[model samples]
Target: MENAYKEIEKGYLNMELLRFTTAGSVDDGKSTLIGRLLYDSKAIFEDQMEAIERASVGKGEEEVNLALLTDGLKAEREQGITIDVAYRYFATPKRKFIIADTPGHVQYTRNMVTGASTANAALILIDARNGVIEQTKRHSFIASLLQIPHLIICINKMDLVEFKQERYEEIKKEFSKFAPKLAIKDIRFLPISAKLGDNVVDKSKNTPWYEGPTLMYLLENLHIGGDNNFLDARFPVQYVVRPQSDKYHDFRGYAGRISSGVFKTGDEVKVYPSGFTSKVKGIHFGDKALKQAFPPQSVTITLEDDIDISRGDIIIKKNDTPKIEQDIDLMVCWFNERPLQIRGKYAVKHTTNDVRCMIKDIEYKIDVNSLEKDYDDKVVKMNDICRISIRTTKSLYFDPYTRNRETGSLVLIDESTNETVAAGMII
Candidate 1:
């Protein structure tokens, strides 16, 4: 038992985390694929399995409905559709995973965007019978827009199509024809039957022609170490840490998560807005002092000079500073039911910075289905993706969304209701 515990602890320490989102049209086997992936990998508990089995029996299912594992909402189970985003967590010996199961309906595009915004990889399931549909294209486009590093196109429900290689090739070819238009870095195609447990967690005997790695193997082995931008160092100050203790009386540290790049001790850094320059005195992670800090690390950094740094201020390397702009162009996904009013003011939040912004102009609305720009349609409604210009009250330290996602994204909130109205990516 002690040996097993040691192995578990080692696995926990060595495992890398992977965040992925699943998207497809309604009735596609996304939930089932995740359910199968969890079940076959022994990630699900015995009690959970029993509960799922009982739910299946109560629903009069002939066999256990794997889809029930992710479709947790009553409305989702009753309507036999996903209405909102459902997140699931599981771990294997090699890696840990957080699965964002997004809704498939066209009306839930905002929900999909919210779930997929932070994902490193996107699993776009294409039903074998339907081939490449509108939703597939929409999701694929969003994945590209959001700069998801990896895209795995899973042609699900191969059992219904006799697991034919010809069908799979046809879909792959069709998708590849238009894929060049998008800016996706890595894209892979896979054939699988989510319901029958084929090519999900295990290799399937049905597909003798398919020689690619199984979905589980591909996910586990995919190289994601280089996904983050380490070239342009960006650190947004979240809080100013000033403890009122005797031992740490002189300690003044800036606490924030490293957005990108690297900051090492004695590195010359420039503070945004103020344009104040200082040297990085030390990088601390809790009680231990780190030699350097990189992307996604939440650490406190003390500087050599006492600069007036506050929340919303960014610390960047002197040579690699980002754009300081008040007027910004963005590709925004409108999330509110109320239409966007031109010249109307909205509270804009980017990183740790909060500022008010006025809509300058509606550049054009994107027809997600046809991938065309509708310049005539200035009325931005719910689920409408459009490019617009906005002028902020204060200058923002930002990079293009394609370059660094952490520093490139912002959201507009309705001041009256204090609800998020739109999500935007800086252009």
Candidate 2:
């Protein structure tokens, strides 16, 4: 048993990771779909399956409820609804997956944003009997707003509609009509029965008219290498590493994660806010030196020349730099209970830098359901998304969210309470 456990752990460490989020209306089978995926892939432990079986029987269920696998919280199981974001990890031979099962209610829109913010792909489930509804549009709009690279519209509960091709076509057509308005780069439609395990992992024999790959197959084969911004190099220094040792007495290295693009040894780089130039002497992961570092890599970099670089400083290729400005425009998603006050002073955190900012103007609040700009309403409350302009105490170096997600995002915090009030994407 010990040897087998070690082998399984080794295999997981070698697999590539894919993060995805699911959104759907109540009882649309979002949890069940994820449960089905895990079960069919043989990712669940036997003990977990046994526990779910017991719970189902206790609830007087006729069949083992796969949704019970993800709905772990007592409230969620008792109410038959997901409130908070439930994250589950599973792996197949080809890849590992991080599933963010977000709540479907409109009130929990903030939860969906929190889950999908870092996802590479989003699964928007639509009930076959209901076709496309307001919740569908709301979730679809949120997925597009987050700039997720891929979107999969799963027409779930196909068995309920007798697996009819006509119903699938109807929902597909309705979704296609509104998709052009969104900023989604790639989109695909799949007819699935999460309850009966049709097309969740293996291809369903019932859908002869369908020719596309199953959800599992698409997830495994999807090209995600190009999803990150590889052209723009942005490294936000998180800490300054200076070891107090005899062997490395004069060593000064900047420690941080490469948010995007590439950084190589001996490359000429410029520091933001300071405008000082330096050359990369070496990149070290620890004791070993790395020739290059790319997106999402954490390393310590030694510079050729000593410069006044700090935690908030950003290192980038001199020629290709982000716009530095005190005045900024962004789409803000309000997270706190209190409504956003115009000209309100709040702390703004961009990358590794922190500064205070005031709301200069509220351009318009977005009606997510209708995708309309509510110019008349400027009061921003919880779960409200709006376009707004702000003025910061210092210059912020950033790109549009569409250009680079890592460098283009920020959050606002209420200083008095130190609670994060809103999330923003540069526009």
Candidate 3:
């Protein structure tokens, strides 16, 4: 038991996390593919499997419907569709995975944007029989707009197309023509049958002509180490930690997740908005002291100088400071039903900074289908994406969304209702 426990702990420590989102048209097998991936990987518990089995029988399914595993909501199960973003977690020996199964309907495009916002990779499913359709282009455009590092185009439902290599090749060729227009760095194509478990977790004999890594293999082995912006060091202070206990009264640390780049002890740093200079005295992760901290790590840092630093302040290398500007240009994806009001005041949240901003102008709206910019149609509505300018009440420290996703993104909240109205990516 001791040996087994040690082996398990070692495996857990060595595992890398991969966050991916799945998207396709309605009935294109997004949920089913996730369910199949989980089931074949042996990640599903026996009791959970039995419950799904019972539900499948109640629905009069001839065979157990794997899609039922993810359609957990009563409305989703009744309508036979995914309405919201359904997140699922599973782990293989090689890596741990977080799957965001986004809705496929055109109305839920906002949900798709929210789901794929922080993803490292995107799994775009194309129905083999229908080939590349409009929804496929929409999702692909959003994936590129969000700057997801990897794109895996899974041509699904090979059983319907009789597992024909020609069909897969045709769809691949069609999508390749459109893929060049996007800004995605890496794009790969694969053929799979989610229902029959072909080329998902294991190699399928049905596709003898196709030779490629399985979906699971591609996800587990994809290179994501270079996806983060490591050159520009940025640390947004989320909280100012001060120990009140008598044991450690002198503790003053700024705690936040590293948004980008690297921070190390003894490095010269500057506080944003105040322009105060300081040296890093220490970096702490819980009770353990770390020599350095990088992106996505929540570590408490102590500076040599006791400056007036607080929440919403950014700390960075003195030489590589980000642009501190109040007027910003960005691409906005409107998420509310009410049309965006010109010159409207909305609360903007970026990183750890909060400020109110007003819409100055709508430069153009890009049609996701054709990638055309329309300067005439400025009325932005739900799911309408456009490029606009905004002037903030206070200066913001940010980079282009293409440069650093963590520092380059923000959300606009409706001041009256406190609802998030839109998500913006800085240009």
Candidate 4:
């Protein structure tokens, strides 16, 4: 009992926030599953629960509609669906979490790609009756394309299917066959009823024949320790902090978030594009100096020499540097009203780096439903994922999105309208 309190207190006091995302076909109970997690884990306050209950009553639901807890926007409430990526925050005794409830519409594939890009794991829900549909493959393909390490295929609304073991196994067999073609490492399937609160937070008595940890158990115990690259140090300077007056005129610092690995004081690092060399003099998270900084943390770095570093420039270990290339191949999910031009220019934003790029060649288009490649349809339209070659004006220093998402991904913006046209994962 004391240990439980300690764990709860520690989580309430200081818990490391872990971010994850959920993607599935529309009305697959993604929001309900999340609501069940938060509600059953005791993450919701009384007032919040009251509000949810009140909203559910207003919506003419007999019981509190758990999906109402997440569908907070007016459009989503009216439509009874999620439109964009809705970010929800909650905490448990084990971890602090942020769940991005992404849309499943074909037109909203871009939103799923965006949400999955930074997620440690992708919780993919499958309706027991629907089995593996086209949207399921599309979501799974996106998770694989984004290189999400862990995948939880929650077979939801099992009660509707009579909680049949054969049906569950059949779905498992189907998904297993398709998973080998994906680039995922860990995969698990759970038969859950988000509506009845079975095997989501609590074990389901209806499925006494099945034996496995509840969905909550997996979420709490999943190993996310190696999610970030700890060996290759890369930091992109976002801002330069310069306090120029008679008081501290000599002060010059490079401010940015560490993309990967660990950077320590006095470490020898190279400034990109310029080939200039410098040693880290100090690390500042805020006002104080730290000995080192690590991934996903924002900080300011003061170097030993003022070597003409600017925003969008990367700092890395002198020996372990990423390749700088002008021509590259990337898997892109086209998301826009306008089609991609065969040979057109775009503003490519990758991490903190941005450059002008043009389509050099169309490699192939991937069929999400069938996993087939169509080479003849070179025309890129909305929600069609295709691999293509692009040539950037300046060399982009990066790696495969599979190696490092922060350095390996790029988003294309229309040059004329300044609208985000597509999201790409470098191959």
Candidate 5:
């Protein structure tokens, strides 16, 4: 299949990046768990470790707090609470990882949605001492609603609960009740002590009755390559590259990342809005032509015929076009401090297209903790996920979020300030 963005991308198509988010209630040791993963995986540099040690010394702590490694903000360091989503990067021989450690506080629930929006797996921390709290269910709901493939329930602070098998079972039992209502397909629960380093990297000597793969083992072995939508091909054109230089004067290229499915060098393709068909002449990364392209890859595609294609136009297979509708129903998480207005006019960003949209009607408000849909509440507040309908000025071609996150997901930006106010997933 012809991918339209193969002619204008950086040539080398060699690296892979995995985005995973850490979530849980406040004091659930999310930051500490991330530090443990980085430390145990031997991904931390000496300078980074030195800074952590110095920070520990300043706090007069006996041992360096591993959570300090990801909590880079001054307010988070001073208040001992994560205020914003903190991202950390590290790599192992098996895979490269990007950790989006989001705040566990309820008010910052919007941050968790932002972090987990693109995550393949979610690391949910549960404090053994408190068992399953209200916040536990909230994060789980968000992960499922976002259509994340895997959920790892890390029962943290196991040492404080004496590593008792019964206590762990109790918490697990409570969570199992609510798991049925979620969209999660695979769920695994583990007992861990983020503070004592139990069952995080290597197996623990403390939990003698428990035996399972360590957190690192699960992350390294989880099959995530097949997590993308293989049936639908959606590549939103980011830019049209045409160099006026001597050698490449006639070169025309469409540059963008392949959001889903696969693209081959000699397949026929179509461009949206204009509904023009073209054949794939050559698929190039920078200079070398590729045999094919897949999800999460950024490449430049050169077509056989020059058709009028520009930014915001999606390149997709002709027969497998998405449902184009002017109105859509979605679950939206309001992220703005300013209250959401009824029948408000905001710019809706779907894929690469931005159109003026109006909030038609709120179907219902979802209780994140209970996973219950409350239709009686029509008003959407900050951090609330309400099923809503939006009518756009132009029709948008989209698939369900479960099928294609790249095309099915969108954001609502305030028209005046141009700030993102909500994130939505098509239902």
Candidate 6:
């Protein structure tokens, strides 16, 4: 039994994971969509189904309230609203998935940002009856800002709209009018009834006019292999491993996750800030030696020359390097309740490097609803998105968030309380 469990765990870890986030206005059936996905995929356990069934019965619901599968919080279940980011995991034969069901309330915009930060795709649901609204635009803008590769506009509650093709087109047209303003590379539309499980996991007969792939099909087959920046190599040093044993006394390895591009044995590399150049001696994954490594892969790298390297340093091709600067422009999303003060000092974290920084100036606040820049409003509050300037005490290595999401993003921690005050995308 222990061996069987270990085999199962190994198989799961080997499966490719697709991380996606769901965002929609209140009552747009975001929870129900996730519940349906888990249910139809047979990912739910018998005990969980029974618990949801019992909860439905206790609430005097005629049918099982599928939303209860994700609305796990007491207050959320009672209020029939999502208050925080609810994460769900499931797998089909094709691939494994991690779903972040973010709250639709405007006040929880920070939560939505957090959920979609690492997502490969953003599933934006819209009420078929209501067409496109301000919240829809806001979420779409956030997805664009975060540089999510795929944008899926699920027109939910199509059953309520009688599955009219014209209504679907109308909403599609409305969204298309606003989509060009975003940085979204790929956008697809689907008519789905999350409650009825139509066009979600299977094709809907009611919508014979639609010829697009179902939600599940698109998710499983979306080509996301080219999403990372493969041209610029970046490896941030996280730890230095030195096995001081007699058997292998000369093993010096720098352990870190490959941020972008590729690295191979015998490649010429340089350590950041120090400008120490060296040749790649070897790369290893635990006890196994590897010839090459790429983005998202965690490995230990060895250098030909023993240079002074430590945590917070970066390794890259000698000729290919990121910008090292003290002053940087950033598109920042304020997450704290207290407004961001100009010239306020805070701890800035970029990649593995942490240093002190001050808010140099506020350029303008973005109006998510109208997609306008309010140059007059410099006061950034909670959930406010704005472009600002920051000056750090020391130079840091970075790329534009548009160029590399892994290396371009950062967070500010308040010195007084150590709370994450804002999330920034290096401009």
By TM-score, the best candidate is: 1
Give a tens-digit lDDT track for model 4, residues 1-427. 9998987676677656678889864488877788778877777789988998998898788987777777778988898877788888877767788898887887788889889888888998999998988888888988999898889999999999999999999999999988889999899899999888889888999999779999888887888888898888999889999988898699898999988889999999999989899999999987788999998889999899978988999999889989799999999998898999989999999878889999999999998878899999888898899999999999998878889888888999998999999998898
lDDT of each: 0.92, 0.91, 0.92, 0.88, 0.86, 0.91
lDDT-better candidate, 5 vs 6:
6
176-240: candidate 5 lDDT, tens digit per residue: 98899889898999999888898988899888888788888888788887888877877888888
Q: Provide the clashing-pair count of each candidate structure.
A: 0, 0, 0, 0, 9, 0
Please identify model 6 stretches exceeding 4 Å from their true place: 1-14
RMSD of each: 1.3, 2.3, 1.4, 2.5, 5.6, 2.6
Better of 3 and 5 by lDDT: 3
Residue 276 Cα positional deviation in candidate 4, in Å, after optimal superposition: 1.2
Model 5 poorest ten-residue lDDT run? 7-16
Ranking by TM-score: 1, 3, 6, 2, 4, 5
Candidate 4 off by > 4 Å: 1-9, 43-64, 245-247
Better of 2 and 4 by TM-score: 2
Cα TM-score of candidate 3: 0.97
- 315-412 per-residue lDDT for model 3 (tens digits): 99889989899999999999998899999999999999999999999999988778889989979999899999999999999999999999999999
Q: What is the alpha-carbon lDDT for the whole of candidate 3?
A: 0.92
Report the lDDT tens digits of candidate 1 across residue range 169-213: 999999998899789979999999988888888899999999999
Q: What lDDT score goes with residue 149 in model 2?
A: 92
Cα TM-score per model: 0.97, 0.95, 0.97, 0.93, 0.92, 0.95
Which ten residues in a row are the worst by lDDT in model 1? 23-32
CA RMSD (A), model 4:
2.5
